[model samples]
Target chain A: MKKYNAVFACLLLVLFTNSAAASSSLEEYFYASGKIKVVITVAAIVLIGLFVYLQRLDSRLKKLEKNKIEK
Target chain B: MKLWLKILCAVLLFYALLSSFYHPLAPGGLTVDIEKLVPGANTFVYSGYNTHFKDHSNDGLQFFVSSGSHYYPTEIIEVIDNNHAKVNVVLPDTLPSEEIAFYANTPTDGTVYIMKPMDISAFVFHQNYTNGSVPVKVANDQHQNFGYPFQVIIFESIRNLMWHVPMWFTMFVIMFISFIQSIHVLSATGRENMLDSSMIYVQSGIHDRKASASAETGLIFCILGLITGSIWARFTWGAWWTNDPQLNGAMVVFLMYVAYFILRNSVNDEEKRARLAAIFNIFAFVLLVVLLMVMPRFAEGLHPGKSGNPAFSSYDLDSSLRMVFYPAVFGFILLGYWIYNLRLRIKILESNEEI
Candidate 1:
């Protein structure tokens, strides 16, 4: 619970400090949209890859059972 | 071919379309001019639409504005042209950090999307303007989320094509299978020989209380089609039930199929039950076509294609949407067939043991 509280406070500080962020030359919001798009694409690729991997494992198990029966 | 594949493809298509909800097909664009558009500032920035001055096309976007945060319809004074307009007195000021909502009624096109629609429900609140630029993103000053990237092609009433239209295809396939099996049974050259008469055939039982696999699959598709259809109605028409002739007729057909099952179970003799149900299936199907397809067009309905409100056959399909909608239909129908085949096998085994 204390750890959670610390994390929450950190989040609050980051949010409140955003207005002050304009002083920095980086202007993080400018890259925000592109960063979001990259995250979405990466997540989608991971999910689709996971689906294929799981499906392959399932079929391989079935094949092993078939081979054992034949032997 | 599989339920998972169909659901995945359909959901992806829905999400893709949902992602670009604001883009429209027409040429003219939307513009919000803040011509001194501050409150108590009567002659505020003007908001309207623009057609390519080249094409002379017009999209309507008319709005009334005032500074006090309260919009009075009395504010709109006159229309100078298709693009520009005047309004009544607006207050020149507002409270600090305050967001005042000014209402714009865009009934026609998206070229004039000054009024932001938050949901399907919010669409009802705005006054109707014709010929406005379709909105790409609903802008809210509260969020500062400007210019949403939604590319929605107006597949109006066609989304119903997914749930309402495909049931017929599934029904037709099941009915066709039933017809073929019936023919096979009749041509088998002998009955009471117990082979032809056996309720033991899973395809369409010969002598037992179990219904054929085809019938169960048919019932599942019919029932699911009915349910999704009613849910689709909630989003499209905002009501669960309407006095649509086609809707009523389809309900009757659905109930008739339910009755088909009950009537199949009530009888004890296998041969009599199979023969009777087969005959009824043929008749019920013919009635289904007449009710779901024929009656709606002639009877006039709230549904599309029937009442001339909208029809897929009448419109050109955008290549993007056709890619998704067509596959979804095929995938779902194929999955329906797989379910039927499974049910048929179960019936055959059950009948075999009755000996």
Candidate 2:
């Protein structure tokens, strides 16, 4: 349950960080900057999603190992 | 499961990644320095983005003023730089409106046009060259081989179609596979209950596991798709999220799947969870079709294929784009399937108490 809460907090942090970066960069940068920023944001999202997915899989594997040890 | 298929997916995606970045945007759009024009000799400085006007001499460049379908030739005064030019446009006796479109053409850039009508505010200006209707002078229609379409605003962002669109397409394919698996699980359970035996329940559990695994992978792709889409929207539409129908529909579909996961976690019994989730999955699939596909077409939205915007077919993905686009679609779909397959195997191992 604590792990789940931490994951949710991390997700919220990512969401807020993304929105803040998007709004600030648009105001700060010119035309060409927009493209680079967009590419970075997209790549970041994919990497984060994959990371979270792997974390879930790791937790499941841990649970299976715990059950095996108890038996 | 096959090594060769996984290798192929990796190779195709690598090719797509390389090609999307390497290809350059074709030159287009003519920007004018002046906003207003008079009937007599008027000078307007012209420039373009990614244009090859510098390659052409004063003789090679042509300017024209177009009102409706009728075009009147303008005299080119000087070719200052490759990107910039000075034009002496003599106003015609009469224009359709107070504002008229100006166009510039080069052998390499084809025709770069500025459709923002420059206001002809001067009362003394009149076309004295011809008494009758002046025939529109057509510019040279020379095509340059740049290997990509050059739209005005979309410019370089056209490359995102390779990465962003395929994510959604791959997600849809995986979700559809999940939907099919869910149906099989429900039917298998139905058959077993009718026979008054728990034997078929084992088989149905496997199907249920596969279905859930597919949905899990599909959700990952969906999240990636939405994130990429939002980034694209920020640059193109000047907002992270718009009130567009297609965008809203996609969000709703994503939310529906989130609810599915929540529902699955709430139910403790394996058989009951599978049965309930399978029913919900079928309902969600139907809603996905309606929200993402059907409803967007009828309403006005900023997205392509909506009422106001032009669909993908209108632009016509020329041979150049199709070369990379088709491969990207195939690669992403294969990759998605591979991930789902791996997840399903893990689920099977878990249920059997195997490491």
Candidate 3:
């Protein structure tokens, strides 16, 4: 869990710095076509977040089974 | 949790995912280049979004400048492209009203209109002025195509309806399950003595595990809903977090549930911890209902279904949107339940190991 927090902090730092840089072309790409890329970005965030949660649950379950076998 | 139900959930989710992004928006008026209307011949380039103007140019493409009940026909001087047309209309010396609306009709796009505040100071407003000499044909038929309604500023981001809304709905369902389990825990404990047999305590423990597991799953969905809603608010409402009553209410509910977990972890004794958490869960659920459901309706907020703004049911959630939205809601609820089921089993297993 601590490792995941560090990873999330690093990801947020990168995102903030990238937005602060003001990359016009990247901004233009997202703002094009009535800002449809905004929807895409939102969808990506949801899917990634859910998948990460599923992975955590899977690992925790595996760890429990390993402990049971060790006993 | 059955095989068929799981398959149905997967299929419904797949359909919603594909259709929400794949469907196009219905053609609607975008803008006109002219800012002001004059007394004589007025020409402007009319532009439309997803409209087939050029293809239907020969199909009796007509334009009208309508003020009140009178309609003055305009000539389509040029068909510039599929979505652009040059229109010219001659205004009379006197008009019934200052507010004028432009209308374009085609067999494909039906009747699309734009009513923007323009400078009509040049025309005189005679309330009884009527133009009976000019033949007016106003086609009131709408486009026969099935597409999401085109809205200004919201444009294509309206597709987020499928993803963002269902997250809250799923959270609500999961939390309600948690609420029910918490009630069961309280009741089971109430029926027995303090130092009861191990079997009754175990039963209450199972209920406690189920309650916390469901709440944990519900929290995941609530966080997802918040993140998606924040992104959507940033793009549409021009702010990541608004002072809307509904938004603040959601934040409070989130923090309250977090506090519920803290209350659970603080008490080491299983019976005491379960009773305390169950009582807190009941209060949290009531607060959730009040904050999310009851308060938003009475307060003025940027979200739809508020005090002043029209609800999505009245205008926005059209037939095309309902096709995907209902499936998405059901799919997300099933997915949430599936996750809650797994978490409950894991919690039960971990507790049994300790005993």
Candidate 4:
């Protein structure tokens, strides 16, 4: 839950902060033939975020298991 | 299956159905029967009648009008007739003679027939004969009229219905489940784990302070619903909001449920919160159904799916659109279910330990 909340917070920050900037940056980032640094940064964040979410889920499941054992 | 997966599948199906049945109005196609608007280049005569829905008009001309939610229309061609036969010349804005030349986008099978040699062969032949003319040699050199197919791009924002509305539905369904569980906890104490009642009602295990899965998801869904709805309204209705009773009623319903969430959060006692929240959920859902289903019948809105609106009926629903839109709604609902389940599981995990 903490991890989900953190990810949510990060998403709100990155996305809402950039709604006005999307037309230019998103076009540059996702345009079929466009070349720019924004695309690379967006790609990196997605990969890193996915990694973190999975890690958090794994840890949460483990914590649940540990509690179950002690109980 | 995961709830999100089901919702995804449903949404994809809905879009596929819609796309299959609903086609954008294209220009230069054989219009079943519509008045064509022609431009003037020295000559000033409209080749069709003036009407919103009919007049055998020429194709390829675009008009900009502020209709509904759109601030500036992309482009619209006026239609005024229905007969596939010959048409009239609307004056003040059309070419003078049948031999007038013009350009447009690629022509389709159904686009207006340009007044050319084929369309004017009889008129010219009659004039030549009246002038004591010998049979003129057939001249077939020019084809200035290229058909610009009629292209109408509708707002695909109907796609958001799958994403936003389902969130609320799923929220309600989950909240209903929570409501049921809370009642069970309150009613059956012998083996139902009385200490964990708070998970079903107010907060989580010891200090998580997380309300029921239904409440949080419901709130999120409500927010998303408003944002997407406003966007759709801007594109379709020409305004973010109108005096439509259905819209107002829905807003009221949403606010009521949001208040329910606030109410649940305000009261801290485990026993009082669970019982009260459960009761509130029941009332809120009942009101939601009433507003969505009943209020629309009495009051008119820019929304199409109501009874009196011809726009939302079979006329608008072509076989093409059914392919996509149907599945999308289902997919969204399924995804909502998935989210609810995941949240419920998380709550259970949090509550399992007595710490």
TM-score of 2: 0.85
Local accuracy by lDDT, each model: 0.48, 0.76, 0.85, 0.44
Per-residue alpha-carbon lDDT of model 2 for B272-337, expressed as tens digits? Answer: 999999999999998998988899888889987677677554554445567788898898899889
| DockQ of predictions, in order shown | 0.03, 0.38, 0.66, 0.09
Structural RMSD, model 4: 13.1
- Rank order by DockQ, top first? 3, 2, 4, 1
Q: TM-scores across all candidates? A: 0.49, 0.85, 0.92, 0.51
Among these predicted structures, which one has the highest DockQ?
3
Off by over 4 Å in 3: A23-29, B132-141, B194-196, B316-320
lDDT tens per residue, model 4, A1-71 = 77678877987788667656665664334332212132233223323543553465467678888877887
Better of 1 and 2 by lDDT: 2
Superposed by TM-score, candidate 2 places the C-alpha of residue B251 at a distance from the truth, in angstroms, of 1.0
- Candidate 3, B1-355: lDDT as tens digits: 7988889889988987897789887777888999889888999999888888898888867878888767888888999998899998998879887668888888887788888889888888888987532556665437665676777667788888888889999989999999999999999888787556687798889999999999999999999989989988877787789999989999998999999999999999999999999999999999999999999888889887687776555544346567678999999899889989988888888887787
CAPRI tier for the interface of model 2: acceptable
The collision pairs in model 3 are: none
Q: How does candidate 2 score on lDDT?
A: 0.76
* Per-residue lDDT over A5-71 for candidate 2, one digit per residue giving the tens place of the 0 to 100 score: 8987988897688557886654345247225455555655765776777777778778877887999
TM-score of chain B of each: 0.55, 0.90, 0.92, 0.54
How much is the lDDT of residue B32 in candidate 2? Answer: 84
